[model samples]
Target: MTGMERLSLRVSEMINHPIAQLRRSVTIHKLDTDGDREWEEVMGVLSETDELDMTINDDGTITLKWEMVADEYRQVEADEFEPEEEPVPF
Candidate 1:
């Protein structure tokens, strides 16, 4: 195989690895940009590799670090319904 092709295959294996079942101890280096510059560091256990290390450096940014947990897949509960409003006389 060609050199380029060999390299590509290796990368593909590392990324799309089927045996790459969810492994604990997944670290994430989050970097956010919204309000003032700030950072929140935390660790989490996840399966797929996170791309937190790939953050952009700039002002007005906030970074949150946390591992992806099965809880992340939890469904959000619906809020209680509100009563209909009556129309006011014109």
Candidate 2:
């Protein structure tokens, strides 16, 4: 399958998964050219569903919010993996 097809499959899975309803929103970051296209294509697919709304941010990120969720959070930079300064305390 093509990269976009694979991404679409994964995105469909995420959206259809049982726990997806629990998430207030999902942020997709364009980390590369393929990823960027994937985000755009996925957004198009989601637009047809009418169950979520997509917002394209100035920082090249796409945010998908569930229809039932309240919009209370402010947009922030796409989350990047960062090493924690302290170890987890158990």
Candidate 3:
């Protein structure tokens, strides 16, 4: 594989690992009044990975940090949705 391909794959893995870890730690039954605190704790754990920085905002929201990618490397695409048509009366 090319160097760029390998770099892209590694970056993708780095990004995904923390998200997967957070998903594993969370459960509907485990959530309660302390859920926001728990989420912040999870973000703290993820910040240790060094792939991204996490900061808790004054408003209780999280701010994530990562280097900005070049426009050529940006690959975000929004999914297009079509509205469902109503069925005619039989």
Candidate 4:
């Protein structure tokens, strides 16, 4: 599976109820170009800021971790809306 898909699946499985915060640990296939790129795409979808925890494992895989809080999710949603480029008749 692609890195983005794998991460999405894991996060989906992790959530069992409503949550105000969550910590996600995603494993990246560091040696594979496609896998690495997929993880980059996944990173764009997460709410993490300029900081995240990364670890290199003996098994050669890289682990990326970040936490998401309710406030961050709200900000992400708010940022998704843009004002109309032009005025419209209401």
Candidate 5:
């Protein structure tokens, strides 16, 4: 699986229980395009900045909140929207 997917899955597992206190420890490993391997270690408390919410407009536009900020976060323009694409099974 991709690094982003792995991190997301781990975080989801940690927060599955409503009253579960997430551990402050987490790590993500991946390889760069140039074939360099790297890892990131999370060592602090993670506070929720926003609640997860999504809105779908009648015109096929969508807005997702609380998406992690990282290099992998891609932005698609309005003109490039693909209506035929299948929705991800979140």
Candidate 6:
């Protein structure tokens, strides 16, 4: 219940989060990158994450904002106590 919401956290802070470890893809927004080696080094850490897209931002900080329906909400796809078909007796 603590995940599935749009949140902005530092890369180090989210590295081991449950949501970050999920199989879902992630989008990184980096509006501007001044070509500073420092930011590149900072962003390089994202290599380990499942990043689907990325955009450089002026601020050298990881901005993670995502909402996954499967994680936010779940529904019972089948009837409760579904039983298998019975075989006819000879």
**How close to the true structure is residue 14 of candidate 6, measured as C-alpha lDDT?**
59
Looking at model 4, the pairs that clash are: none
lDDT tens digits, residues 1-90, model 2?
A: 887877777666666666665675776665454676676777777778676778889998777787552332321222344445797788
Over the stretch 1-90, how does candidate 4's per-residue lDDT look in tens digits? 866677656544443224312445655543344465665665455435454576668996656666775788888888898665786768
The C-alpha TM-scores of every prediction are: 0.25, 0.52, 0.32, 0.34, 0.25, 0.27
Error of 5 at 30 (Å): 13
Where does the lowest 10-residue lDDT sum fall in candidate 1? 34-43
Candidate 4 lDDT for residue 55: 68
Error of 4 at 68 (Å): 1.6
Off by over 4 Å in 4: 1-23, 31-50, 73-90
Residue pair clashes in candidate 2: none
Q: Candidate 3 at residue 64, lDDT? A: 54
- Model 5 C-alpha lDDT per residue in residues 9-76, reported as the tens digit of each score: 55555445333323322322233431222122211112322444434456533233344334323434
Local distance difference test scores for all models: 0.34, 0.66, 0.47, 0.57, 0.38, 0.45
- Minimal lDDT window, size 10, model 3: 24-33
At residue 21, candidate 5 shows an lDDT of: 22
RMSD of each: 16.7, 12.8, 14.5, 10.7, 18.2, 10.5
Q: Pick the candidate with the highest lDDT.
A: 2
Worst lDDT run of 10 residues, candidate 6, spans: 1-10
Q: Where does candidate 6 stray beyond 4 Å?
A: 1-9, 31-35, 45-90
lDDT of residue 9 for candidate 2: 71
**lDDT tens per residue, model 3, 9-86:** 543454557664444221111123334455455555656866556666675544555553454234332223445679
- Candidate 1 per-residue C-alpha lDDT over 46-65 given as tens digits, one digit per residue, 9 for 90 to 100: 12236433232375232323
Q: Candidate 3 — which residues are off by over 4 angstroms? A: 1-37, 68-90
Residue pairs in collision within model 1: 32-62, 44-67
Q: What is the descending lDDT order?
A: 2, 4, 3, 6, 5, 1
What are the runs in model 1 whose C-alpha is more than 4 Å off?
24-90
